[model samples]
Target: MAKSFASQGDLTEKKITFDEVGPDLWAFTAEGDPNSGVIIGDDSVMVVEAQATPRLAEKVIERVRSVTDKPISHVVLTHYHAVRVLGASAYGADQIIMSDAARGMVAERGQEDWDSEFQRFPRLFEGYESIPGLTWPTTTFTDRMTVYLGKRRVDIMHLGRAHTAGDAVVHVPDGGVMFTGDIVEDHSACYCGDGYFGDWGTTLDAIAAYDVDAIAPGRGGALIGRDAVTRAIASTRDFVDSTYAPAARVAARGGSLKEAWDAVRAECDPKFRDYAIYEHCLPFNVARAYDEARGIAHPRIWTAARDLEMWDALQG
Candidate 1:
């Protein structure tokens, strides 16, 4: 029988944008792909999220070069997903930062996640060989850490458990811009393969309370203005709810994984069918939702073998 998988090449690289959010704060966004934020200080710079590989990161570096010559001295990884953290080496930052919880997640399942993600989406991992190794944090803090880029203050906070147990957001108070990693998405789908669905909603609420004027979400274009920010947050929440809630209910009703998958498809496909990565994310989302509804607190680590098994079980 033919393999029941879509080609990863279907996703193509698009142009990236650099938009000013505030004084010395900018959002580096691409069309519905992973985004990176730049916080420029008087002397140095801080990168919010790294792309999937060094080659990919250079694209952002080129953009950063066009506006400022400030050296990128730090990289803040919002979470421990392979696609997000693996490109840290390209930044050549003096310090790599993450939440304590995020560091622990890397120590626990980082390797497995690396293998699983590469297998799931080969297109994103274009220069797979360039990955130095699993990206590890040089500095980690619990709750929050305040860093000074000359006179500017950048607050890095864990906020709460959402996308992962250690999701961090970079809040630029002076700039009134927030770099929300996977916590907020504009038009892209949320990949809840390793998420806390219930806690994720509350986490978003906390982020909204920041009264941000602009937002650089994990994926999609940069959100401008208060209304755009609110709309992006709401859309992200709706995507999570519509994707996981029906599956959770079906699982509670004693339905099998396949059954729950069907229910989720029926409920969410109409709305999210055309969104980027929707097809790539559904199986993993359902697997996670099923586990959560069954009272599983921590998300299971996904290995390449398990990915295939889940896909086969649900898609067959």
Candidate 2:
């Protein structure tokens, strides 16, 4: 039997939490769902990673209002995934910031991703009609951009490609906090369909070089200490390497995608089965690993139709 695409089969309402990990900084997390970070500067506020839809973002907004009444001055999009970028319009930000590569990703496959992700996860896109359209960043930076709110400074850096070609990290040196958007997850499946497995490890290494006190990952609970942060980053690296290594080797040896996926499943499932979204990510992760093994540098656009076709073939 074919399984449901992405997270559509998951219907349980998650318990949401807003935890202040540092001075004037909070993390909005819904169990293992996409997490957003809030930075309240002296004069304004910056939100990291928009939820999935406009209505969904309202929940995050309500939380933000409870803490500070400052207008949401800047919205930082860590990457261009539909689940992360579509709800940006609801923030009413003066400038939506992203890496130049992310802006290019929006231009290339944002619409297709919109259609693809909506079909895969209906619960995330609760008010699908409320989305004004594709979220576009008014400000684009290549390497890094500094955002100042009074004396507070939030540095957004394009830490090489990991989850996507445009993956960016939000670092607050003064706050000793870093918002790693999907680059590092604790007990959550790293969605590798659009990932660069090889480059991802190096990116994680660079992020680990920093003396981060806490981390607001794209998914999962906020890492509150240096040990917890170190563990989460290491786990993310392990998952990425364990999934890609076998698939790449199999593909090089004239093996098929199914064979590679089976190898990856046998290796990773026992260790990661209890992780969030592990079941949903397996098929896509293996597929991309196989493609990269075959020397496909870029990920193919995943559409709603293609999602089902891939599910029927892989899950059956």
| Candidate number of the best TM-score | 2
The deviation in Å at residue 59 for candidate 1 is: 1.0
Q: lDDT of candidate 2 vs native?
A: 0.91
TM-score of 1: 0.97
lDDT of 2 by residue, 1-316 (tens): 6657658898778899999989999999988889999999999999999988999899999999999999999999999999998999999999999999999999999999999888777888888799999999999999998989889999999979999999999999898999999999989999999999879999998999997999999899999999999999999999999999989889989997778978999889888989988887888899889999899999988888887877677655
Could you estimate the TM-score for every candidate?
0.97, 0.98
Any runs in candidate 1 off by more than 4 Å, and if so which?
A: 2-4
RMSD of each: 1.2, 1.0
Q: Tens digit of lDDT per residue, candidate 1, span 1-316?
A: 5254453545676777899888878888877678899999989999998888887888889989999998999999999998898998999999999999999999999999999988878877878889999999999999999999999999999889878899999999988999999989888888898999989899999999999999989988889899999999999999988878898898878999999999999988999888877887888889998999999999999999998898889867
- Candidate with the greatest lDDT versus the true structure: 2
Write down the lDDT of every candidate, Cα atoms only.
0.89, 0.91
How high is the lDDT of residue 314 in model 1? 83
